[model samples]
Target: MTDLKVRKLPWEFDESVPFQWNRENPRFGIMMNAVSFLAPAFERFIVSSTRAAMAQITDPATLEEADAFLRQEAIHGRAHRNHTAALVKQYPGLKQVLVDLDASYDRVLKTEPLEYHLAYIADIEATFTPLFSVMLNHQDKLFDIGDHRVGPLFLWHFVEEIEHRSSAKIVYDAVVPSPWYRLRVIPKVVAHVMGCFSMFCRAVDTHVPAADRGIDACDMIVRPKRLTSLFERSELPGQFEGVPRTEVITMLYRLARAQAPNHSPATEKVPAFASEWFEAYEQGKDVVNWYRPARVAG
Candidate 1:
């Protein structure tokens, strides 16, 4: 788990910071907040699923990694809960959207088999691993565009997400160990993630007034290049687009393959800055000093 550190972050959100914090891009900001709204619950799911599997594993190294993963997730969930609490209070209607997400997660937790839960963890973590890379690679641009205070929370979260990317797969393979089982479960997991993402976007758009709304990217699903840029750059005032359902599914296919018995994800390198940040933390140095973009030679 790369020595996962449970750093106490200063995460405080309020109406003073616009709802669309990312360069005032309404939909982008909403999408980011929507993810935050669902994060605490989703992280709790990860913790429970991983811990349940950890109970059955016998390897000491796996057990240690599992413990560290749980601690990091526990802190992550707390930070997100605090932020989301602030969000729902500002926009009361968002409570309903979060309720819907909670209901969906509850239904799965109560009905699905243990393997399904493990598969879901592996599925989402796989997606996050590469997604984190994209964010880290473009952090300077993203942070510059977004609210500075909120930026560190995301920076901290995604860095740790990359650090523990393999924990779920490690636990999943230990327990399930069947390629056939993964193939069946992976699609279902992809469907769930994408479905929830769509629901969150719609919910945010519905409750947030048009005057406050940024460009809606929902209509641009077919444009892959634009969608790719969404992750790499902040959207300007007039440019709004999103990832297509088919493309998300295709990306999930590749992510799932990386979780296969003998394969590795092509984009597995953790960003150099993120590595340096955590390494500094381990040595009791001020990691905030390393969060800035590396200076380029002119």
Candidate 2:
């Protein structure tokens, strides 16, 4: 992990895993594209969170670690943007959509204050840590998207979510000198989640199907054979290297307990995500089964 120095945003990543946007597979590409718009917004929040709380971060070691955290997020954002561009070549309309989304982030920055922004980051990533676990454990959760490419990208993002679950809070606690931050950030983040969901829903309505562009993360969890249906159609067996959904959620709870103070995920007012995670675990799925590590793949 120490050697995993953070990389900057907008970096190049080759995402040529053979994706197509047909009627049945309508949302895979769109979901990929939709998540793509979040990159710039995500990046700006990280950068601002880091700087906004700079004065509070006293430990040199912690600051250095936070710097690496920022670096990785930057890399993620850049890679996604470039990936979006490559996909744009396939779907020309997305280019304008992507630009508008980036512009929207700028608009958000101007509207919200620093505390509100950091709280939103905490809330979003907090929601992300769990929802991501379901996707990260695609097989166990039984989310059979029936594709090889998107899952890997999503897994990579999920792992990174775990990697930096504590960053925003760390920065906020260090820099922002307000007890209200602890209380305020939660509701503030909840509101942000509402707005963010609306944005995704809007994007989905404009682009893909209801199921494909889900309104809540809970809807995505599958109950065995559900996810595999897609891949079966693609000639790949439904079985894949996914971790246990319960284990994944448990790991997140552990991480949450470690990351969030006072120990209540609900007070954290989590975005509408836990049900999706619980269902994935109810399905007793694990994505590690679908995962082919780079070492083995190579």
Candidate 3:
């Protein structure tokens, strides 16, 4: 029901490659380190809160999916954590960034009630769905990835993000129950804009050498021109194209009210994109990229 079959996922949270990659790849290393640094700050809160909040969910299938989500997110967090630990072994100065960010972000989130957490999730999921889905659909356009391991990892995570994007919003919107909640997402958009800059700058300062410190942290993985293409090409606004995707996605809740058919893998199954497609996403076998840029850091 929840599509939990692991597809070509890397062995459970390997630290060797990412950690070694960090030491070798300065730009990517710092970017990813910042990801781990800020993750415990904002995302740890979300994952832990989401895990707890999910217990109240009654739908057996959804509950299972949330558990899977918890597992997936925890894996991601750990990979990033190990990456940071590798950084700390090299430079003890880096730990302060995580410490400061966690304290500040937690202080902010702690002041808000459950509604704020739910609303933040709703907005984030809404923003993420269309973006990842579109790229998963359009696989051929992949640019030069330079490295073999990290590129496919990027695409795999991207596909899964598309798959689960609606789940959080579906969960949160159930309780928030406001059309205004959709519009309220505008401010939440700031998190990406602001959070990226804050996290990246901090990481660069901590890790980049005094001479090359001028170089941006994520530039190697995220080429500048492509970054622009990602914003314009993803066509996320298309979900709101004729009518809003949110409007249709909201049906996840209505499914309960109307007593819709039960969710089953028989009905909601995945093909084995596990082969070549998942790496760059073959059109047919991979998720039909829902008709979307493609991008990320850390």
Candidate 4:
């Protein structure tokens, strides 16, 4: 069995959690909030896909991993639902955003074959280790400075993502066993995920007031060239403006490498912070309020 622990975080987000949770970097917070919109629906799709794939998985060990992965994802979905529910309570239109997002994934689950769902999950899960490594490695900037209630929710989610990085690919290999097929499906998967993110951003723009979000909610959905132009013009704010070109290049390279046919998440370099976060959790540190000195003190 994989060393995947299904830990419940002490996450309690009530009326006080701001839409701009990351006060230092509202854009980053809003970008991640878009993810909050996506996580519950996408994770449900993951659970459904894994349940269908389980019948065909012959290996007991792989079955165990899939079960653990589903449990972890279910917990993730619940935590994100709590967060999103808080948002929707504040901005009622976000309820429709959730409805629309769920419908989008429901369409996929209904229309796509089990293999396609597996491939879609595998393609997206494959990138998390690398993509989140960049974010976790820069936690001080991206997470630590954010709201104590909100930052650790994402931190916990990302670290667990690193822990289960291999689960989706293992299931996919057991069922489909075709790297070329996985690669072939990447474009569609990317388009689908990006389209969902765009929808979330547009909804944020429509629902949340400008003063509340403190940045263009649609900024994150822009084309790469436009992003680069904004970066060059010094229009980007917070950590985005100071992100090293080399760091961005390295992250892009690692993200591409993650999707390669032979790529093994087992061999990927994990961020040091992931290990530290795990250790902290094991030691009973208050991970839900990770940045607060009193809560984090061991």
Best by lDDT: 4
* Model 3, TM vs. native: 0.59
Q: For model 4, what is the alpha-carbon lDDT of residue 280?
A: 96
Better of 2 and 4 by lDDT: 4
Query: Stretches of candidate 3 above 4 Å error?
Result: 6-40, 133-144, 188-193, 210-214, 217-298
**How big is the positional error of residue 56 in model 1, measured in Å on the Cα after superposition?**
1.3
Model 2: residues with Cα > 4 Å off, grouped in runs: 1-4, 7-33, 139-145, 207-260, 263-298
Residues 1-298, candidate 2: write the lDDT tens digits.
2323342222343445333322233434444445666676668667766665665667876687567767778777766776666655544544665666666666667887776666666556666665554444453333344444444445455566665666666655565577356555565555554455456545445553345333333233343457444333333222222344455446556544533544433233232333443344347544233343443486
**lDDT by residue for model 3 (1-298), tens:** 6765344343232333343232233443344344456554556666866776776678777777667766666665554565456556665666776776767657656776666676665555444444443333433333122123333444555556556655665556445556465455546545543564565565656564644433455442344466443224232222122223454354334322222112221232232333344445434432322222233222
TM-score of each: 0.80, 0.62, 0.59, 0.95
| Model 4, backbone clash pairs (residues 3+ apart or across chains), number | 0
Worst 10 residues of 3 by lDDT: 257-266
Better of 3 and 4 by TM-score: 4
Top-down TM-score ranking? 4, 1, 2, 3
Better of 3 and 4 by lDDT: 4
Overall lDDT per candidate, in order of appearance: 0.67, 0.52, 0.48, 0.87
Q: Which ten residues in a row have the lowest lDDT in candidate 2?
A: 232-241
The digit string of per-residue lDDT tens for model 1 on 160-249 reads: 888887777777778886745765777688677766777777776777665555655354232435645434434353223334445445
In candidate 2, position 95 carries an lDDT of 63
